[model samples]
Target: MFKKVLVANRGEIACRIMKSCQQLNVRTVAVYSTADKDAKFVKMADEAYCVGPAKAQESYLNREGILMAAVISHADAVHPGYGFLAEDALFARMCSQCGLTWLGPQADLISLMGDKAAARKFAASRGIAIIPGTFVLNDPDATERAALKIGFPLLIKASQGGGGKGIRIVTSPDDLNSQLKIAKQETSSAFGSTSIYLERVLKHARHIEVQIIGDQNGRILVLGDRDCTMQVRRQKIIEESPATFITDAQRRELIVTVHRLLDGVNYQGLGTVEFLFSDDRFYFLEMNTRLQVEHGVTETTTGLDIVMLQLQLASNESRLSRQIPSCDGVAIECRINLTAPTNNNQLSTFSFPEGIRVDTGYQSGDNVPSYYDALLVKVIVNGKNRLEAVTLMQKALANIKIDGVSTNLHDLQKILASSWYKKGVFAVETLDMRLEKHESFTG
Candidate 1:
């Protein structure tokens, strides 16, 4: 096992990863930016290093600085807790070349799956159905031709990036060229790659994702699926395990299909197979080659520590049991962000009710930095059933208090009380509909 692991990220994920490391009796090294010098994660680490300035390019995303920190800290492995360079194939290669165990998938697999266009082809080749889409297009003529074939109401997405960046929705052909231009520019800026692909957008699609972990020996473990349909601007805000509406047969098929696809690629470590579900059909979106933001809920449902499994797999020291464990209960998670209500820099009081896991990187009196992601904490609850989980979440959210900083607590409370949300029939557009109608449910 790795004696020390360097977490090459920040915020809630960084802290979450460190906790797993602690459970495994592994020391943790944290890398921070100038803006996070006094962050809670830094203080929690056995060793902490300031990589660079507040800007992500100079700090959290600074590959060289992170590498140097690992070297200085003598960490045997590096766990990139999603985002930043977690899915960057080159960085994974660099870590392996430096004799450090690279958590998550290998470099080649990361490269193959990171390209949204190529991943679609790969998925289709493995018998996983993909959405009606076109491969990476370079020029306006090619894009126009593809758009004509795909019809209006299509999404132009960046081939090399995720996290809802570098994507544009064009409702009609008259807006195609302009939207394509903007997507390319944003893609270039965000991922440093201008590759873009187009996919037919389904109205009222629910974002469903399957959590998968594999080993170097080709063993794949399906940790179950999550319904991340609740979103604002394509960013998931609420997620739950064992997707609510899908039938048992459909759930089994989804898991089996994803397992086959991952095995075909000889994928290693943690990954997520994301899909858009509508009309009782699953359309492959893309695979994320690292720990997901909502992994906490899955962990709660499965009773597994994903970060620990990543370490063991990367070390090639342990193999997962062949028997798949049954999911015990329903789990729900809400992302508490610094945005939405307000951005008060200071966090006066931060507390949550019992029977919930609060994964956070902030503490009372800590100044929330605008230089990074707005995520303040992930509130996770587990229960005997969906309704039970939802009820527990309500109690947790209602009693929780985080003053001095603006958070999405109120919005989340409204969502929990919404009628559509309670029925388990809500789609991605449900929240938008509530907002448009200015409806708020107190129940």
Candidate 2:
């Protein structure tokens, strides 16, 4: 096991990773920016280093600054919880070159799968079913030809994008050029790439994902399947284990498909294979090469500490079999976030209810910064079944309270009690998709 680990990110995930390290008796090194010098996660670390100033480019995302901190701290390994440089293959290589263990898959896999276009091609080459999409195109003639082939009602997505950025939905050729121009600008500014790809968009698709890992034993571990259909602006806000609407056969197939896709890769960390399920078929999206923000839902349902498992697997400490742990119950997680920039960012009345696990980085009297992700906490609950879990989630949301900042409390409640939610038939667009207009998904 690693003696010391340096967390390369900040906010709630930093706290989440540090807590897990402490549980393993591994010392933690926290690298913080000037803006987060006094954050809750900073105080939780055994040693803290100020990387740079407030801006992310100068601090959190500064590759050189983070590497320097790890070397100076004499840490054996670097754990990028999520976001920021978590999936950057170059940064992972830098850690290895510096003689620091990177708690993730090898850099080659990250580089190959990080590019959406390359991932699609790789999946197709492996005999996996991928969504009908074209390669990254920047030429005018090639772009027009690909659009005609893929047909209308498609999405123009960034080749190197995640977290729902640099995407444009188009339904007609007339709107293609306009949306394409917009997507390129966004992608260039956000990802330093001007390339974009087109793929067919399934309407009212359920966002189902399988947690998988290519263990050190050259075997695959399928943790479970999760439904992240409840989302806004392509960002998932609610996730649940044992997807409510899929059949038993479909679930089994999903697990097998991902396992087969990852088999013989010699990978040694956690990853998620995402799919858009509709029309009784699954369309591959992209693979996430790092820990997901919603990993808590699977942890609560499966009785496994994923972070611990990640550490163990990375350090060759856990030699596992192919069997997955049976689900303890139905688990649900709701992400609580600051709805918008509040007049007063300082938290005043911060409190959560009992009977649920709340993972957070803030306590009462903490200042909520607008520079980073707005996520405040992840409220997770598990019950004997789906009905019980839903009831518990509703109660937990109602009992929670906060002040001096606005949150999506009302929005979460509205979605939780909607008729679509009770029926377990909600889709990725159900939150914003007007039920009265979309007769197919209406109560």
Candidate 3:
């Protein structure tokens, strides 16, 4: 166990990580910006430091400042709670060189799997099914020829972009060139990379991901599978465990396939291998090499402490005999975020329902800084089965009360009540296509 750990993030995830560390008696250090000087996570930390100003590039994403905070606080390890340098290979390597443990997989693995282009090619070479896609586009004529073969209604994607930034859905050949340019610009501005690729859209695909963890002692655990089909613009809005959409045999096949996929990579720590499932088959998507926002859903279903697992693995604890805890029930998570700007950014009266798990970064009277993500709350519910979970979620959602900001609560309730969502008939594009008419989505 680590004596002290520095959390390299802010808000809900930062708070969440600290809680787990405290449970293990590990002292936690929080690094914040001036904007978050009075934030909840900062107050909860045993020690806190201000990294920089409110801007993420200067604050949360400041690798040097965060490292300095860890050194000054005498933290034995650093935990990057999901975003903001969590997957940055250079940052992870730097931590190791400084003799501080990095609570993640090896930096080389992160680099190899983080790039979408290289990951896709790697999956294909492993005999894993991949969506029809091209490598990094170069010469214009060759790129056009490749696009024509893959057909229109394809996606122009930034090879290094995530969180739905550098992506364009080209519906026809005429729009391909313009969409490509836009995607390139977005990716370059966001990721410092203009490298892009193309993939044919599988019309009615579902977003499915498998959670895996490996230990230093050559042990592995397949937590379970999750269905993230309910998404708005490629960002997952709802996530549930034990993906009910797939049949029993298909579920077994999925587990076996993913297990084999990570068989000999000498992987350690947590990871998620995503895929696009359609027409009784699945194609490999990208892998998230860090803890995800929706990880609690899987945790609830399996009754396992994923964060604690990460800590134990990082310390090379060989006695961890846990192996794939049986999935006990169906669990669903609704991420409530602000859809539009509001008058007062501070929470006037933020409250959540009882008898359910509500993980949040803000309490009543906490001011939400405008600099970071607008995700205010994560409502997670677990029940004996999917229907029971859905029923419990609806009631829990109804009990939530937020008086300050404009959020997606109404939309989330509508989604839970929708017949398509209830019946698990909704595909990846189903929510986006439905909301395209009425709701304006923000990235």
The most accurate candidate by TM-score is 3
Write out the backbone clash pairs for model 1. 342-406
Over 4 Å off in model 3, which ranges? 217-219, 318-322, 439-443
Candidate 2 regions exceeding 4 Å error are 435-443
lDDT of 2 by residue, 2-112 (tens): 999999999889999998899999999999998888898999999999999988889999999999999999999999888889999999999999999888889999988
How many angstroms is residue 5 displaced in model 3 relative to the true structure, after the best TM-score fit?
Answer: 0.7
lDDT of each: 0.87, 0.87, 0.87
Off by over 4 Å in 1: 340-344, 436-443
lDDT of 1: 0.87
lDDT (tens digit, per residue) of candidate 1 on 1-443: 88999999988889999998998899999999998999889999999999999999899888989999999999999999888899888899999889898887889888888888898989898888899988888877887998999998999999876667667889999999888888888988877889899999887889999988888776788888999999887789999997977899999889888876887667788989999898889988889989999998888988988888878877777888786657888999999987743444888898887768989988888888887778889999998999989988988999999898778899999888776687886787777666678766433
Clashes of each: 1, 0, 0
In angstroms, the error of model 2 at 122 is 0.5
